[model samples]
Target: MTTPTLYGYYRSSASWRVRIALAWKGIEYDLKPIDLVKLEQKTEEYRKLVPTQKVPAFVTKDGKILSQSQAIMEYLEEAYPERPMFPKGLYQKAEVREICQIIACDIHPIQNLGVLIRVAGSDLEKRAEWARTSITLGFKGLEGRLEACSEKYCVGNSITMADFFLASIVGNAKRWEVDMSEFPIITRINNTLSTLPEFQSADPFHQPDCPEELRKN
Candidate 1:
């Protein structure tokens, strides 16, 4: 089968989640960088490709198109189950999805680039503060949830989809300067996950589209 294609911005948290999942599953997909900072995703061509005009659009080998990071990651979990991203237990899987949704649906949207641009415009400080507040509020509940569910990872022991969401958002939290001290569980999990080769390969700073000054050597 031909490789899938992913269109994503380098710094997008949702895109990073998909990248981590793809890397963890050992899936070789073509990455077509959509530079959000350049307003590339707003182009008419891109709009036709993705009606929502969002990054992390995926085209499967069989010509199936997918959008939204959670949907795409779930697709990967089902299609390539060898290195499963979800737990076998139904309740554990639900908890995993709950954590992913808490980040994606509740926390991320308010602080995402699109929302930041609309809410704070060009004032970088305002944008940072808005993001920081949103993330801090979200992390409060998230930390409590992790305290209950986490062992070595976000769920029981093994790394799952929840870990991907956690790792991705922690990067964003740091970006907005949300003091991570209050979220010790999150900090520990993120630090642990950062050491994995899959997470390293999927890092925003390591992506081809990252700016030279920002790229990790």
Candidate 2:
């Protein structure tokens, strides 16, 4: 099968989520970089590809365009079942999805690029505080759930959708200088996941378009 194509901005947390998912599944895809900082996503050509004007849009080899990271990850799981990211059993799968949603729905949307931009006009510091607060609250809840479900990864001993979601959001939190030490479980899982080649390879800092000035040495 021909490789799929992914359009994304390097620092976008949503885009980062999809990148980690793709790598974990061992899927090959072409990366098309979009400069969100430059407002490149507003152009007509890009709009045609992503109606929501979001990054991380996927175009299949069959020429279908897909938006949303969760949807793309689900499609990847369904399309390529060899290296599965979801748990095998029914109850385990539900747990995995629940953990994944804690980040995807509860945490990510409120702290996304669009939300941040919208808050820019308001008191910038206050907006950042809001983002940090939301993130911390989410992490606290996830920490409790993870304590019960996690072994090595977020759910069970294997890397699943939960790990991918946590990795992506933790990267975002680090950028904002939110201390993960407050949530030891999350900190441990995040540190462990970061060491894996799949997670490291999918890191925003490792992306081709990543800004050198913003990179952590």
Candidate 3:
């Protein structure tokens, strides 16, 4: 079988979500870095692979292509079920997906690269403010939701798909300098989850394409 390939940018929260899932599943695949900063994803070549011109595109070993971080992660869960990313109970599964969508749909899009560029142009301060505002507001609701379901992880004691989204978004929140003190639940969960080998290995700072200056040894 051919090796599966993952096209993603190191700092992309969407890309980071898929990376964490792949790592947790112990999936072996090739990684192709798409430089979002330089508009690499918008190029004609990459566009053919993903018409949306987004990162975190996955090409399966059988040549099936999947886009959108949540969709790709769901596919991984079904295709490789040994290490489940979801809960077995119907309601529990829905709860996990709810947290993922809150981060992916309601929160992430407001501060992603494309939106940030369109809204703030080249103004770094504007971009940071835009991202910060979205994250701060999103975290308020997210923290409340977690207060009802969380234990050691976002949904329960076990690490599910929600933890992946939580860990990835918290990184973005810190990047924009969002105050973590206000959302103690989110901060606690993220701090606990970040230490796992899967999360650590899939971290943006450790990706091959991360800049030398930005890379963590």
Candidate 4:
């Protein structure tokens, strides 16, 4: 089968999630880097591909376009079941989905790039503060749950959907310079996951568009 094409920006957390998922699944894909900073997603050509003008849209090999990273991820898992992101057993899958949703549905949307850009002047700082507070709160809840269930990964000794989701969000936290000392479990998991070649290769710093200054910091 031919590899699907992924349209995304290197620095976008949403896009980053999809990238990590693809890497973890070992699925081959063509990455079409959309320059968000240059406003390429706003062009009429790209807008037609994604009417919502969002990053991380997946164009399947058969030519189906899918927006939203979470949906794309679910599709990937369902379509390619060889390496499952959600493990079997009754409660395990549910727990993984729960953790994934907490970050994907609850925290991320509020502080997404488009939302942050809309905040004005001092309000931008307030928006960022709110985002950081909410993210930390969510991480605390995740840490409690992970501490109860995690061995090496978020759910068990093996990596699951929850680990991917949490890692991606925590990576976003690092970008904002949000201190992770408060959430030791999350920090530890993030450190461990960072060592994985899949996660390391999927890191934003390794992307072509990563600003050298940001990487140096």
Query: Which whole-number lDDT from 0 to 100 does residue 195 have in model 2?
Result: 90
TM-score of 2: 0.93
| Count of residue pairs whose backbone atoms collide, per candidate | 0, 0, 0, 0
Cα lDDT tens digits, model 2, 46-162, are 998789888889988788999988889899899888778898989999999998899989998888767877876557787788789889888888899988999988888888988
Listed in order, each prediction's TM-score against the native is 0.98, 0.93, 0.98, 0.89
**Which residue runs of candidate 1 sit more than 4 Å off their true CA positions?**
none
What would the per-residue lDDT of candidate 3 be over residues 131-198, giving only the tens digit for each residue?
A: 99999999999999999999999998899999999999999998999998999999999999988999
Compared with the true structure, what per-residue lDDT tens digits does model 4 show for residues 1-217?
Answer: 4679999887888888788888988988988999987899999999989999989899877789999988998998988887788879889988888888888887788777667767533476776776787688777777787778887788887888787787789878876667788888888888899888878777787776677775522
- Root-mean-square deviation of each candidate, in angstroms? 0.8, 1.8, 0.7, 2.3
Candidate 4 lDDT (Cα, whole model)? 0.82
Sort every candidate by TM-score, greatest first.
Answer: 3, 1, 2, 4
Candidate no. 3 TM-score: 0.98
What range of 10 consecutive residues in model 2 has the weakest lDDT sum?
208-217
In model 4, the Cα lDDT at residue 54 comes to 88
Q: Evaluate residue 158 in candidate 4 and report its C-alpha lDDT on the 0 to 100 scale.
A: 83
> Which pairs, if any, clash in model 2?
none
